[model samples]
Target chain A: MGLRVLAVDDEADFIETLVKRFTYRRIPVTAAANGPEALARLDREDFDVVILDMRMPGMDGLTVLQEIKKRHPLVEVIILTGHASVEAGMQGMSLGAYDYVLKPVDFGELLEKANKAYERKKLNESRDHS
Target chain B: MIQDEFGRLRLKLIAITLAFSFVPLLSLGLGLYAKFYDTYTDKIYGNLRNLVDNKKVTIDMFLSERVAQLSNLALTESYQDLAGDAYLERIFGVLQLHSKSFLDLQVIDQNGLCVSYVGPYQLKGIDYSHEDWFRTVMAKGIHVSDVFMGFRKYPHFNIAISRREGEKTWVLRAAIDSDIFDTLVRTVQLGKSGDAFLLNAQHVLQTKPRFGHDMFDTVPFPDIPRFSGTRVDEITVNGQRSLYAMTWLNLKDWLLVIKDDPAEEFLPLYRARWLLILLLSGGALLIVGGAIFIANGTVRQLIQSDREKATLDASLTQSSKMAALGKLAAGVAHEVNNPLAIIMEKAGWMRDLLTEEDIKASPNFQEFEDAVTKIEFHVRRAKDVTHRLLGFARRMEPTQENLDVNLLLEQTRSFLENEANFRGITFVRNYQSDLPHIESDASQLQQVFLNILDNAIDAIDKNGTITITTHTVPESGEVDIAIADTGKGIPKETLEKIFDPFFTTKKVGEGTGLGLTISYSIIGKLGGRIKVQSDEGQGTTFHISLPIAV
Candidate 1:
C-alpha cells in the first residue's frame, strides 16, 4: 500500500497547496481545514502519517494530534503553524507529534521530517505486532 | 544657532547702531566755519568803510569851514590891522575861537613867503613858496594835500586857501594829524585776526596803524576783483589767504577793506558744528545697530528653526525605517513558512514507505534509511530556524501566563546539555531555593535562554563551562536569572552593542547576529530587563530580571 498521509490546516489555501505538492510527489494525501474535520477524517480512515496545524479554529491542532496519538499510536503526526512558537513545538513533540513545521512550509524538508517520523512509527508498530 | 529668530535679530541691531553716528558732526563743523567766517569778514569791511567815509567827510567839512571863516575874517574891517602887525595874541585868540579843529595855522603871501604863523610853528615871516600845497594854492587859489610826513614825522593832511591882497595873494594853511584817522580805522572792529585798512582807488594801505610809513605803499591786491556789491571776496594778504570784504568810502575817495583769517575766526563755530555732527553720526550708528540686530535675529531664528526641523525629520525617518524593516520581515516569513511545512509532511511518508518489508529487503533500503535520517534531522533544524524567523517577524503580542521560570530554565538546560557535553563543556544549573513563579511568555523565555546559550557556546573553546542560575527576591518581588560562561568573553567595546541587531563576533555565515537582538526584544516585551557583564579574556555573564506576577 501507498504511504498514508493526513494534512490538517485552518487555511484552505494552505491545505490546497499541500495537496498539490503531495500529488506531485505521488504521495497518498487527505486534508482537513479544522480540528473537528481532522478528527472525523482520522476516525474513518487510517493514516500512516498525520500533519496537523498547531493553531486551529476549534479543538486546536495540538488536541487533534494528541487524539491521533491516543487512537492510532502507529500513525505519526506533524504539526504546522503560521506562528511557530517554540513552546508549541515542544508541547507537540512531547505529546507524540512526529515533528513541527512552520507555515509557507518547505515541502522538501517537511517530506524528510515526515518520512523519518513515519518510519519510526512503522518500526514501533511492527515491534508491537511481533 | 539655536536661538529664536527675534532674539538673534536683536543682537544684530545692537551691533549696527553703534557704527554710523559720527558722519554728520564732521560735515557740520566744516559748514559752520564756512558761514561764520564769511559773515565776520563782511561785517568788519562794512565798519571800516563807514569809518573811512566819516573821516573823509569830517576832514572835508573842517577844511572848507576854516577857509570860509578865515576868508571872512580877512574880509573884516580889521583885516588890514590883523594882516599888518596888530596884536598877535588877539589875532591868535580870534582864529582859535573861529576854528576849534585846526591844530596849527599859517598865512603866506602870494610871493611864497610866510607872513604870520600860528601857535606851534613859531616861524614868523618864513618863506613857504616851494611847498607843494603852497604852490598849488597860489596857482589855483585853493588846494588840498594828500597825507604827508609832518611834525615828528606824523602823517598829516592839509587844506590850503589863498586870496588876493591887491598885487599879491594871501594864503592860509592848516595841518591835521593822521592819528585821528588811525583811531577811526581801529574802530572798524574785525573778527579774530582780522583788521581793516583804507586803500585808495589805487589800492594802497592808508589810515592803517602803519599809515605814516606805508602811506604811499601799494595795497596787496587780491587774486580776484573785489565785489562792488555787498559780497565777500577770498583774498591773499600779507602772504596769507583770507576772506575779505571791500567797500568804497565815496566821501574819502578810499576803499575800506577788511581781511579775516577765516580759519581762526570760525573756530568756536566749528567746534559747535562738530558737536552737532557727532550727534547726527550717533543717530546713524543707531540706525545701523538696529539693522544689524534685525538681520541677526532673522538669521538666527531661521537657523534655529531649521535645526529643529532637521531633528524632527531625522526622527521620523528612523521610525519609518524600523517600520519598513518589520513589514519586510513579516512578508518574508509568511512566504517561507508554507514550503517548510510540506517538506516535513512528505519526508514522513517517505520514511514510512522505505521501512515496508518489500523496501527493507531491497539492497538500497539501508542507504535510503540513512539518507532519510540525515534529511530528517537537518529538516527539523531548518524548521526550528524558520519558526524563530516567523516569531521575530510577526511581532506577536505576548500572552503572559503564570509559569515556573525555573522549570523552563531546567528544560532549556536539558536541551543544551547534551550538545555541550559533546563539546567537552559541562553545563551547570544554579536554581534558587523556593523560587516564585513569574508572569511571562514561557516559550519566548525559552528562546531567550537558548540565544544566550548560543552566544556563550560561540564565545567558548573546548572545556569551557557554562553555569545557569535562577533567583527570586521576596523584598523586590522579582525573579533573576543569570547565565555565566567561563569562556573567551566579548571585548569591552562591543559589549554594549552585543544586543544590537546584526552585530556579531562570529565570521560570515556562522552567525546571523539576530539572535541576541530578538531575545532582547522578547525580554523587553515581557517587561523584563537584560544586562551583560564581561571581560575580554575571562568570561561573560547575562542577567535577566523579571517582575513577579501580581
Candidate 2:
C-alpha cells in the first residue's frame, strides 16, 4: 500500500512504460488505454490517485475526471497534457485535479506528484473515517 | 555636366517650341521680302519704260519737223533760181524763223557742186562729185545723214532733199546742230544712282551716262535685243548690283539703257527686313524662355512624384516579404513544438534514471550522462528558437480597450530605465501632456514600446542617448510616437530588413530578433503603422502612428 494509482492515456506504450516505471519506484499502478476504460476500472478499484491524459479517443481526461470525482469523491487526479493543451489542463486542475505536467512525462516528477496526491486523498479519507 | 531626366525634358521642350515657332515665322518673313522686292522692281521698270517712250517721241518730232521745212523749200524754189544764193537765203530766213535748229543751208546742182551756200563757211563753188551724200540724195528723194564734220568742220547732222525739174535734179541740204538733241534726252527723271543713256547697234553710249561709263564708250550686254519693248534684267555694273532696262528706238539704230541700283531703289524693303528680323528674334526669345520655364516646373513635379513612388514601392515589397515570412514561421514553429517537447522530456528522463549507485560507478556512465545532457541542451535550444518563431507569428486576437498611450509608454520605459542606467545611457522622454486616449490593447502596446525601447538601448551599446517624443492630432484623432537614438545606426542595406523576423545585429544567443517583428504585427492588428529612418554612423529613428479613438 505504498502508493495506489491509475494511469489513463490513449497511448498503450506510454501507459505500459508508466506502469513499469511506477512498479520500479515501489508504487502499485494500474493502467487503462482510454478514458472509459479508466472510468470502468476506477468503479472496481479503490485507488488513492488518478493520472489523467487530457486527450483520448473514447472519453477525454476531463470527462473521466468529472465522473471519478462524482463516484469517488476522496480520489485525487493529476493531469497530463501537451504544451498546446496547457489551458485545458488548467481547467481540469480547477475541477478538483491535484496538478498538471507536460509530456513526454518525467516519471520521477510524475511519481512525486502522484504520491503527494495520494497523501492528500488519504488525509481526507482519514478525516472522514475519524 | 550631363542633364538629368528633368533637365533633359526641359531642354527638349524649349528646343521643340523654338523650332516650331521660330522656323516658320523667319521663313515667312524672308519669303515676303523676296516676293515684295520682285513686284516692286517690276513696277519700277514699267514706269521707266513709259518715261523713255515719251522722250523718244519728242526727239523724233523735232527731227521730222526740220526735215519737212527743208523739203518745202526744195519744192517751192526752181532749180535755175536755187542756184543763186539770194533765193536760198530767203528760204533759210523763213526756216530760221520757224525753228533755229539748222546750222547751215546749202544748194547743190546736178554736178554735185554746191551752187549756193547760206551759212558761216564760204563754199559757194565747192565740188560735190564722187561724194557719198550726193549719190545717196540723187537716188533717194530725201536722206538724213549721220553726224559728221561738214564743210564748216563742226559736228552736225544733215537732211538732204533731191528734186527733179524736167530731168534736171537739184539737192537742197540743211545741216542741223547736235547740241539740241542732247538737252532733250538728259531731262528724264531717274532715281539716285540711276542712269539713262543711249546706245547704237555697236553698243556705244550716245548720251552722257551719269555712272562710271563715259560717252561714246562701248557698253557690254549678254545679248542685245532688236527693236524689242522695254525689258529689264539684273546686271552687275562697276561691281555694284543694278537693274538694267533696255528699249529699242524705232526711228534709229539706237537702244536706251537705264541702270538702277536696286539696294538704293528698294531702301524701304531693307528697312522692313530689319524690323521683321528684330521682331522674330524677340518673339523666339520670349517663347523659348517661357517654354523652358514651364517645362522645368512640370519636370520638377514629375521627378518628385517618381521618387516618392519608388520609396513607397520598396517599403511595400519589404512589408509583404515580412508578412509572408511571419506566416511561414508561425506554421513551422507550431508544428515542431510538440515533437521538441517530447524529445526534451524523454532525454531528461533518461538522465534522471542513471542515478543508481552501481551504474554511476561504471566507466561509461559519465559518457552516457554527457550524451543525454547534450540532447537535453540542444532540445532546450530548439524550444527557444521555436518559441521565438511562434511569438513572431502570433495570430491571437487582441483585446481592445481604451488605454492611455502616455501611461503605457511610461510603464514600458520604466522596464528599461535600470538597464539604461547600468549601461551609462541617457533616456530622454518627451511625452505630450493631456494626449487623447486611444482604443487599443494595453498589453500589445506595452510590448511594442518595450521592444522598441530595448532595441534602442542595445543599439547605443555604451555611453549614448535616446529621445522619445509623442504627439496627438486633435483633428485626425491620431497619435505619433517618435523614438530617436544617438547610437551607431543601422546601415541603409539593413534598414529594409530590420522589421523582418530573425534579422538582428546582436550576437548569437543575445537576441531572438523577433522583438520588432512582433511589435510590427501587433501594431498592424491595432490598425497602426511604423516607419524607420536611419543614417549610418549617426543614429536611427522610428516613428509609430496610431488612431487615438479607434
Candidate 3:
C-alpha cells in the first residue's frame, strides 16, 4: 500500500500545505495542530509515518516523540523544526526519530524522508508479525 | 589626558625622591660647616693669645733689668765719683759688657746740670732742670721716660735714679737703645701678613710694625678691655681682616700687640668648607638625576600597562557586542524562517498545480510558473541567510578531533580553487611536511580556513598571488598558518574593524560581512588566535595559530 502520513505543527497554514502536497502526490495524509491532537490522532488511526515539528504551543516534539515511541514502537517519526539547533536535533534522534530536518526544506526532500520512514515502519511491522 | 596623568605622576615621584634625599643632606652639611667655623675661630684666637702673652713677658723683663741697673748706680756710687766723666764712662762700659741695650750714660746734679756724659753725644755741660727725666728723678727717686729725640737727635728713652747725700741730690741716667728693644718686641713667627709692635697708652707706636707705621706714629687700635693679661680681638685694618692679641706691659703703660690675617691662619678650615659644599652639590645632582631616571622608568611601565588594559577592554566590548548581535540574529532568523517556509511551500504547491492539465492549458501558465520559480529562488536565498544566522548563534562546545592542519587547509583552499583560478589568482602552498595535528573540530576549523581563503582570494581580486604557509610552534605547542595575498591591501582606517560583524568592504548583496566574524569566533572557540597585518599598497597577511593536540 502507499504511505499513510500524519503531519503535526502549530502553524495551521504550514500543516495545510503539507496536507495538500501529500494529497497531490496520491498519498493518504492527516493533520494535527499540536502535540496533543497529533497523539490523539495516532491513537485513533494507524499511520505509517509522522512528520513532527519540534517547537509547539503545548507538548513539544521530543515529549510527543517519547510518548508515541512508547505507545507504538512500530511507527517511525521525522522531526521538522524552524530552529536549527544541533543539540535538539541530537536529542530528537536519540529519542527514536528516524530523521531531523530544518524548515524551509524542499518538498521533494521531505517526501523522500517520509517514504523512508514509512519503509522502516513496514519493515518493523513485518518483523513483529513473524 | 593619560599622558598628562603619567607626567604628573612622574613629577610627583621625582619631587618626593628629592625631598626625601636632599633635606637630610643639606641640613647635615650646613650644621657641620657651622660647627667647623666656630671651632676654627676659637683655635685661631687661642693661638694668637699664647703668642702675645709670651712676647709680653720678654719685653717686661728687659725693661726692668735696665731700670735696676740705673738705680744701683745712683745708690752705690758717691756724688764726687759719679760726677767724674771718666768714672761714668767706665760704668757704661761695664753695663755694655753684660748687655748691649744701653746707648749712653750721663751724670746730672739735682739742678739739672749735666756734669758727666759718656758715649754717642757731647752734652757734658748742658743746662740743668729742663730735662723731663732729670725733674722726674729728683722727686720720685727713679724715673723711666718714653722714647724721645734727645740732644743726639735720635729716638731713645732714659731710665734715671737720684741719690740724696747731705741735702744734695746726684742723678744717674742711662739711655736705652731703641733698636735693641724694638727687635726684642717684634720677634714673632706668624703666617704671611703677621705683625708685632708695642703701642703706648696714647695709641702711639712704641716700636715699628711689620706692615705699617713708624716709631712714635699714631695708630688706630680696636677698642678692647684694659686688662693686665692678654686679650684677643678681630679687627679690620686697611680693609684686611686680622686677629690681634694685646697685653699691657707690667713695666710701663705700653700695649704689646700681635696681629695676623685670619684668612691665612684658617686656610685649612676654609678648604674643608669648600669641599663640604662641593660634596653636597655633587650628591644633590646625583640624587636628582637618579630620581628622574627611576621616575621615568616607572611611569613608562605604568603607561604601557594602562594601554594594554584599554586594548583588552575594547576587545571585551567588541566580543560582547558580537555575542549579543548573534543572539538577535538567531532569534530573527528563527522567527523569519516559519514565514519563509510557508511562502516556499505555497510556491511549491503552485508549481505542482501548474503541472495539472487545466492550469497548464491557461494562457498565463508560463508567467505563473516563472513567478513561482522566482518566489522559490528568493525563498531559498532567505533560507540560506537564516541558516548562517543559526550557525553564528550556535556557540556550542567544539567537538575535539585530531586534525592535520595542512590537510585541513588544503581541503579548505580547494573550495576556492575554481573561483581563484577564474580570477587569475595563483595559490602558493608552503606546507610543513611534518606539521603536527591539533585538537579541534575538523568542520569548524575547515570553516575558519575556508573563510580566510575566501577573503584572501577576494583581497587578491585578479591576477595576484595568494600564499598559504603552515608551520608548527613547538615551544607554544601550537601550529601557525599564514595566508598572505598580493592584492590591494585593506586600508588602514578599515583594517581595525575588519573582524567586526557586518563590517564589509564588498558591495551590497555580494557579502554578508559575517565571514571574518564567524572565523574569529570559531578560532577562539578552538583555542586559537587570529591576527591580520596589512600595508595599504603592499598586501595583507592573516596569521592563525592553533594549539596542537596534546
Candidate 4:
C-alpha cells in the first residue's frame, strides 16, 4: 500500500540526506553504501523501488540492476548518476531499469519517479499473478 | 628564422646545380679549345714551312740560271770575239733582253785586267785580278760573289766564269741588280706584318726585308738549329712575338727567312677561341641564373608547405588540448555534483523540516528557511555548471536519426528569430530544395545550428543580415551549409581560437565561450567539418559540411 524504497550510494552524506527525505515523506526507506551492500539489502527485504547510484565503489549500479532484475523480476530500479551519460542511461534502461535520473535532482521529482517505478512493479507483479 | 633556413636551402640548390652543370661545361670547353689550338698551331707552322721551302727553291733556281748563262757565254765566245767592248755589249744586251737582272758584264784577261765592259757605268779598264770573284773563278772556274760595292758604288753581286783558250785563261764577270733580286726574294704573300728576306751567314740582309731592313744591312737573326729542310720557329723580333720559317738556298749561303707576327697569322684561331670563351661564359651565366630561379621557386613551395604544416600541427594541438580539458572538466563536474547533491538534499530536508508546525513557530525558523533557500539556489547554480561540464565532455554517444538539414535549419533559426528581430537583424534563408537527408543526430545538429544562428544574431551591432544557405555536394555525398553574417566580423587573432573551449572575445560574464566548441565537437562526431572565413570589417561566414546518409 505504501512505497518501500532503497537508496544506494557511495556518498554517505548524499545517501543519508536522501534517506532522511524519504523518511520525512513517511516512505519506508533503507540505505546501502555500495552496490554489493545494496544487492545484499535487496536479497533480505522486499523493496518496491531501488534508487541506485550508477557509479559506486564496488559492483556498479548496472551490475546490481542486472542482478536484481534476474533475482527479483518484480522489483523496479531507478538509476541515479552524477554524470549525465545518455549511453549509460540507455544501457540501464535496456537492463530493465524503470528510470534514470541525473544528480542534484529535486527530491519531489525523485519521489515522483520512485512512485512511478513502484506502480510499475505493482503492475508487473499483478500481471505475473494473473 | 624560416627565411634564413630557406635562404640556405636555395643557396645549396644553386651550388649543386652549378657544380653539376658548370664543371662539365668548363672541362669540355677547355678540352676542345686546347685540342683546336694544337691543331691550328701545327697547321700554321706547316703552312709557313711550305711557303719558305717554295721560295728557297725559286731563289736557288734564279741564281743557278744566272751562273749557267754566264758560263755559256764564256764557253761559246772566243777570246778574239769577246776581246772587243762592242761584241760584249751586244751579248750583254741580249742577256738583258732575256733577263734584265744583270746590271753589267765585263771580259777580263788572266792578269785580272778588265779588257771589255758593257752597260751601266764606265769601267772599261778596271783591274780585278786580285778581287775575290776574279781569283775565285781563276781557281774554281765558276764563282758567285757576295753582295759588294766594287767600283759600282752600291750594293751588287757578281757571278764569274773562266774560259780556257790555247794556254790562256779569260774571265767573264757580270753584276746582278740587287733591287731586282730583292724584289724576286720578297714575293711572299703572308698576312699583314709578315716579312720575307734573305740573311747571309754574317747575319746581313742580302735582300731588303719587307719591314725596316735594307739590303746589306746587318740584322739580328735567331740561332736556328741545323736542319736539312725548311724549319719553322717561334721567335721574338723587335720585341714582338713572331713565327718564322728558315731554309738554306742551294746555290748561295743565304738563309731564306719568312717571319710573321703570330697574333696576325693565327687571327682566326684566336677569334674562334674568343667565341668559344664567349659561348661558355654565356652558357655558364644562363645556368647560374636558371639555377637561382628554380631554387627560389622550389624553396618558395617548400616554405609554403611547411607553413601549412605548422598551422595544421598547432590546430591539432589545440584540438587535443580542448579534448583533454573537456575530459578534465567532466571529471571535476562529476566529482562536484555529489557534494552538490548532498547540499541540495540536506537543504531540501531542512526545508521539509521547516514545514512541520513545531519548527515553523521557532524564532530562527525564517532565518533558517532563508539560509536553506540560499543554499538551494547556489546548488542549482553549481548544478548548472556541472551539467555544462558533462555536456562539454560529450561522453554520451549521439542518437542517430534521419535529418533533413533544411528543415532542421528552419527550426533552429526559429529559436533566434525573436532575438534577431529585436536587434534589427534579418534572416535570409537560401535552402536548396532538393537537398538530401543526412544520417546524424537531429538534436545535436539542431544544437549546432542554434548555436551558429545565435552567434550570428549576437555578432550584429544593429541593422544587419544573417544569410543561411544549404546545398548538397553530389560528388562528396555531403551537404554544405553556409551561414554568413554582415556584422562586425571576428578579428583574425580571435577567429583562429574561436573553437577553443573557454576562449572568448566577449566581455566578462557575457559568454561561456563553449558554443562553438560544443558545436565543433557535435559536428565532428557526426562526420562533418566546420570552417570559418572572416574579413575584420566586412563580415564573417561559417561553412559546415555534413556527410549524407546512405
Best TM-score among the predictions, by candidate number: 3
Q: Which stretches of candidate 4 lie above 4 Å from their native place?
A: B1-4, B53-121, B126-174, B179-195, B198-255, B259-308, B311-315, B395-550
With candidate 4 superimposed using the best TM-score fit, by how many Å does residue B458's alpha carbon deviate from the native?
A: 15
Q: What is the DockQ of candidate 1?
A: 0.24
Lowest lDDT sum, 10 consecutive residues, model 4 chain B, at B310-319
- What is the TM-score of candidate 1? 0.50
TM, chain A, every candidate? 0.93, 0.93, 0.96, 0.96
Candidate 3 structure, TM-score to reference: 0.70
Deviation from native of the Cα of residue B205 in model 3, angstroms: 6.4
TM-score of candidate 4 versus the correct structure, residues matched by position: 0.69
Instruction: Point to the candidate with the largest DockQ.
Output: 4
lDDT of 3 at B250: 90
Clashes of 3: 3
Stretches off by above 4 angstroms in model 2 are: A1-130, B1-19, B64-83, B109-112, B122-156, B160-172, B211-214, B217-223, B294-298, B355-363, B390-550
By lDDT, the better pick of 2 and 3 is 3
Q: By DockQ thresholds, what CAPRI class is model 2?
A: incorrect
Docking class of 3: medium
Q: B1-550 in candidate 3: lDDT tens per residue? A: 6578899999999999999999999899989998988998888888888888888888888888888888777778888997888888888899999888788988888788889999888878887687665777788888887787767688778888788988898888888877766787667887788888888778888787877788888887665556968788788876777888889999787888998887888889989988998999899999999999999999989876875565455446655875787789889999999999899889988988999999899999999999999999999999999998888777433468787888888888888889988999999999999987778888777777888888877777889999999998889988999999997899989998788666679999999767787778778877889999999878999999988864
The lDDT-based order of candidates, best leading, equals 4, 3, 2, 1
List clashing residue pairs in candidate 2: B112-B128
TM-score of every prediction relative to native: 0.50, 0.60, 0.70, 0.69
Docking class of 1: acceptable
lDDT per residue as tens, model 4, B240-327: 7788889988877778899988989789999999999899989999999999999999998997687556555544664577678778
